[model samples]
Target: MTYFFPKVRQAQQHGWKGQGNKAGGWQEMSRVGAGARLFEATAVGIALLCLGARLEASELRKSPVVRAVERASPAVVNVSTEQEMQRRPGMFPGFRGDSLFEEFFRDFLSPFPRGQARTSLGSGVIVDPKGMVLTNEHVVQGASSIKVTLSDQREYQARLVGADPPSDLAVLLIETKEKLPVIPMGRSNDLMIGETVIAIGNPFGLSHTVTTGVISALNRSIRTESRVYKDFIQTDAAINPGNSGGPLLNIDGELIGINTAIYQKAQGVGFAIPIDRAKRIMRELIEHGEVHPAWIGVEVQSMDEALARSFGLQGRKGVLVTQVAQGGPAQRAGLRKGDLILSVGSSKITSRQEFLEALSAYTGGSQISLGVVRDGREMEVKLKAESLSTQEAVRMAERQLGFTVDAVNQASKKERRAYSMSGVVVRSVEPQSLSYRVGIREGDLIRQINDKEIRSLEDYQTAMARALRRESVTLLVQRGSYGYYLTLELGGGG
Candidate 1:
């Protein structure tokens, strides 16, 4: 519970009771008239009072999140992730590294911890009566073991059902002999800015922690470890690190979002994945093994005020198509660079996020209706979406990393140029990432593995062979601005 009051108020109007001595002053007959008006106002006020009371009673009854926490708490579980540490060679070997001293001293001295477990805890909302759960993708990223404990103190080893890092959401499945009570999902699109929202999660590993606040804002964008998730619901709902993956519910106990992140340094600033997006991902994860995105073969940029005028954009709406991929769906549909996409199907596409979101609703091979504006002319086109390959999906996911990567496709000249390296090239650094943490990215032209200057596939192979043997190794590299080294620690078993 965070609380804030508005800083401004509307001015109230005051009137004289009646005309007394003068026209605007109180007088006997005027007083009688004023009394009648007061009587009417009093009756109205009483009626309003009764109506307010009734509404309050109804709201109290409908606030199921508040009422049902005690019962649902048993289903809301706490999760902890763990991974084994890689073994690192010691400063002095054959001190027979088998002693506790070897374990403790080696772990403490080595750049990478040895046999140590990196752990994180978070909360989850049970969505299926069979013990299937929902949580944030970050909560379980890189985790080799996932342990879930129910409110009743019973524990289970959970398996990852599916996860969408783009949306920063994940789902887990635990087979339990007993039935579980799942929370109902509510329509987050219907939520208002000031409507009450309840967050139930295990913050700081505290089970079933409940917090309340109002919807602070909507359509927020937050950068996670893997991607930039857009259209998040903002709330001052006392969310913390462990709160990630818990359900953000409305007064009726219907889930509106999946609590995902909070500003560590800022108070009352938290974010959640809107239930609508979560629902879409959940469907794909349950149906396929992964979430599939709708792809239009075009690079898009948002139409800002300055760019809109420069491009002579009409009506100040739609996203600018910067580049249309050759032979892609967009190019085949006749979409060209400098064109502005106005809509997908019936939904309007005003920004890049909106354009992407609108397309996510459909799958490959579906005929997509698009409206575009080009050279002062309005045009429409229908495109048949092609099913994206796993490689393509990986490329799309990498885009959120703010890096330039090329898949290994030697057929096309452009692809050959881009795919010279077996792995994607590091074009830029996203603010949050292990690569960024180590300070090695952006225009680096990643050429080698540990101690091996790599110019070709054989070089990379030889380097990886040596690097994988050690717990941690340094990548010798060159950058556009300067040359440096990057030490990468291979985390425990995945």
Candidate 2:
């Protein structure tokens, strides 16, 4: 076969043709057979190359990260909002006939100019087929108009269904005749650290951007200047300004958390609200348009050096129970005054603030376990929370303060004339009560409870209900021409 191919190539190069001679006919026949064999060999090589290339591409496309992004992206949305900016006038009084001067000083005096609109961009995930989108509350806060752009480039007007500022979660509704794609919800309570996670959002106004990272930590707490946020899902994924309210998905393409950019100084550190906590708040928002405060009827105070020593804490951290409401969840669960609460569920309680933060994750009827140290013995007590009511709040306040109050308008003519203010007036005081021992007297006008202003009877009730969650409340009391700020310990009274 080799000898014939060489002879055939040499004969064809020399212009040999099969005209009439037998040698010419043999050369032509050999050349024809060799040419057909060479063409078939080349075709086989080309097919092998194509098959190898296809196999490599198929593996890359089947990657877990790639598949997760593909499954979740369709439910992700770009949220843009428009808000009217309010202008502040100059501090000085208005002057006439000084148009030029006013114009010159406008830039220096006024905080902002009128008739300007502010626009913001963020991300959202569709959690329901009915077009209910979930995002951060700050994304749509004070928004005059909101617009949502789906991954398919379909735009629709969105209206706020409900917003919970404390949880930083909001729900938006977009009415469309067709059903929208939704992301499957996953539990955050069992999320493992260092697990792969994906973040999809509209960072810097770019829509449907995807980033990948692992869960950095769980049950993390982040503090800002104004307030502290707890129970966050910390991740290494890049969460920028517009990434707020985006979905944080696990490797299985399930929604585990809602990404948040509250900590602005983060370099590789990003935080999110755990889906387990968000789920309770979302249900409340969808049903009642707000998250109601849950009460367990126990007042806790921060442990001080003296109190810590008295309770034999040594160096342990916990809050001291100052009071437990009668016939309430805490009382029914065997919780008592002077008991030190070491923890709430799995979270250790060091201060009153931390205790409140832990309890905020739950709603009414939630059964929670409390770790307590009673008489130097450690024990766990379980209690169920109840929705706070005005009647219960008033009863608690009366028993704790040992004082009964009436609205200022319902006071006697002489008392009203003497105390002309918008607050609640003490109608009677228990002689042997803590309030009485602290120099609180009848006819005292209560102007504020903790940080809440008391302008009406409803305001007073609401303030007392919130104060019930704390171990002590500071009251701003006005008596005669003098005013005083008194910190009163709640619970035990005459």
Candidate 3:
């Protein structure tokens, strides 16, 4: 390539040099003169070739992106999961990809029922030398089996420690006798926008793919489920579907955040969970098998001009308290309806999302000084953080199938009847839950267990008891609009 450009120049400027003596430019009487000219041309070509080679080598070293990738690439691993997916006739299996499809592809709504295995791939950072890996909770949520492949080509079966769905984080433990590479975490709070960062991930099943880009923005919010808010570090780095749970590193090769969500349809738009926010959540998950987000028992909305005028507030800023739970922390702190929450501790509250985000910074039982405006007067109120309440069905499911479900009541049944189904509604499926391995889903209906029809909670309990004793319990499940049969083994082998 280096010689091609000079060759083109030589052809343009020295086209007459290649002509015979008949051409006037090379009119030489002796062969010795022509030989001298050839030698001079060869020397100049050599010098130009050497200079180009040196320039290419010099520019390659100027980039630290390669070195940064080498520094953190070893700690990155590929996370692969296998789940049994059962599809019934005339039902929507749901869109589980990272794209914003709103619904699954319309073409997948088949008329024939089918059951098959599903495989999902993502990336993870080995934060612990003992083989404790951190990944996005959605990657292994409904997986029947989990596997982690290291950079050295060694694969290990991973065990789920805990899952925090609201945060989209999960911890996994894998037994390894050999020394494991660990990724050291840096402070995300110290990160500056426009600083160059590297993203190491497995995008589209390609392992250890490195992408470099500057931090485009910070404190970005992406709303997935209603009431669940996510603050992400926006970067121009190419983060694809399989890059979830990977590491976003600084030039010094320190992890600043974990890559979680991305705008699939758009280029140069990716989001990562800050390392600081993930650290506490990781500790809580590994210790308690659940995340206990601090709760104040007050529902709030972003303050608007209309609400501020109605409440007779000063500035139309901060969060507006809509409802306060009786006997809760807000009530105990003297915070009431129509009051505006100005701040939490030292952080200013601008919107309901910001208020919730500030509250997450506190753990259970921590005393926090809150700033609120009432009757156009500002005052400070103190309250202690408490663990958020768990639904009764979730508690029961945790004891039974290691998941959460709601009772199939008249109201719920009416909705289910659209699919010609009946039974409980699955709210959340815990990682490695018993029902998960058998291809059960959040929208699936549990109609019968071991040949016992279950239309109500009492019937479900009775059926569960009998199903627990059988070697392999068969259940008639109505998943969306299609009813199908699923068999679960007694020992969670289904």
Candidate 4:
């Protein structure tokens, strides 16, 4: 090609002649000049043909999926955590890894502890330029140290901002002098059923792995042995153990959900916490360090076939309101006892669990609309949810457990001197109350409620507010020298 360029130029300059033929007619110029012009035209055409082919190949390689990954991959991060665990020996010394035997005898194991350090790997996404990272709570739960690696291989030590175990969402903060890249958030409420979605995560210790799939389903519920997770966005993407906190993006490279691989038994099914729901919890976690249970002051029971028939609602789905707290949100909104709640906002309520899950989306002071059926007529009621007050919490404890508790500081000197720890002390217990039946005495100190440590009145109020929605509440009651875990059945007393 280089040799041809010089020859072509030489031919154009020297291959022309103006001469007369022997017949005295005008003579033709040199054919080399014409050939040179033809060659130049062919070469230009071939050059353009090659250029067009290269441009087409480039366009083909950059599809929407590729572009999305390119735009969002920088914000994806690898999360590694180290945790200290206490390993106890099994009853059968030789059956260490036997699944059947371990499952059968797990509860009978003794508390003989051995110290062990465990390391886990997961993925996260940077949501804020100030180094706010969002990941699953289980990723950093009980971790002694956390390390976050960005897409650029820059590693930083991370501190836990807050975690909500019930929601299974957590926030982490990393310190850096410069701003970090963040993924743009997208809404999940308007997501189509089969739209294209991409998941970016570290799967099996593989960093920044990309997988593409469609939204398989929405508002899906997953039930485990311990509890049920509701309102999950289901996708067929290949989410594995290490993909727990990664981003699920739409075609536009906007984050629509956080990928979670909770259902390990499925072949291709994976679930994600919807971005809309995650946003609500994220705000609470960042602002308050924890998510407070939103209370609407209504007690509901699942509507069965018999109950539906009794209420003249044969085929409609809803829950029956058994009680509405006086001066609470429901009562103030004109909701009464025996009202059939058909929906909470846009979410249809078919059972008590569904109602609770739907209500959990809102926070305190949020004005929500409830669809109700009163006297066989459908109506909507708007109410503002409020946090349960300390006084109201005490009354609720008495009503539910048949016991009343006061802050530790309010206890008598003898009662206060009896324990060196800080907690609430029982002021009184009704004889036939669930607490009394469980051998809880007046002098016993309540050290904990469920998993929450009750150190003050505010802690007890918050714990009781969250626990009252469950069927049973566990109390760690400390008598003179011994601590007892007592599970009290709620809604037993007037």
Candidate closest to the true structure, highest TM-score: 4
RMSD of each: 18.5, 5.8, 16.2, 6.2
Stretches of candidate 1 off by over 4 Å are 1-65, 68-74, 92-114, 224-226, 301-311, 314-318, 322-338, 342-387, 390-494
Ranking by TM-score: 4, 2, 1, 3
lDDT scores of the candidates, listed in order: 0.68, 0.84, 0.74, 0.82
Query: What's model 4's lDDT at 292?
Result: 65
Query: What's the TM for model 2?
Result: 0.77
Best by lDDT: 2
What tens digits encode model 2's per-residue C-alpha lDDT throughout 1-494? 13245656776677766555778668667677878688778788889889989998998778898888888899999999999888665454566347775676666665555576889999999999999999999999999999999999999999999997767999999978687999988988788898999999999998988998999888898888645788998999999999999999999889999999988999998899989888888887888787666778887778888888887877767888887778889999999998988988778889888888788777776778999998888999998888878778888788778998888774452764446558888888999998999988888888999777898788899888767655578999888878899999765210
Model 1 per-residue lDDT tens digits across residues 1-494: 22222211111123334333356343444565666667778888999999999999988785555575554466678988997767765656767646876777765777657567889999888888877788888898889999998878888889998876556678898866777767776787677999888888888888788998899988775654423456778999899889988888787777888887644654778888888767767767767756655556766767898998898874569888876656778888888888888988766877776676566545555678899888888889889875554444334324422344332234422533342444334545677765677775554555556545666534443344333222345665554435567666532100
Per residue, candidate 4 scores C-alpha lDDT tens digits across 330-362 of 888898888889998778888777787788776
Q: List the residue pairs that clash in candidate 2.
A: none
Quick one: RMSD of model 4?
6.2
Residue 222 of model 4: what lDDT? 82
Write model 3 residue lDDT over 1-494, tens digit each, in one string. Answer: 22223433444475445565444443432344556567778988999999999999987886788777778899999999998766543332365452434233333454332455778999999998888899999888889999999988999999899986657789998767789999977888777899999999999999999988989887776755323444578999988899999999999888999897544455668888888878878888788886666667676777788877777774659988776767878798898887878888766888765776677655556678889888878899999867654432223235446555568766765754535335666656767877887677776777776656777666675455334322345778787668889765433100
* Error in Å for residue 417 of model 1: 17
| Clash count, predicted structure 1 | 6
Name the better of 1 and 4 by lDDT. Answer: 4
Residue 360 in candidate 2, Cα distance off native in Å? 1.3
Off by over 4 Å in 4: 1-38, 85-116, 304-316, 387-394, 409-422, 431-433, 436-439, 469-471, 489-494
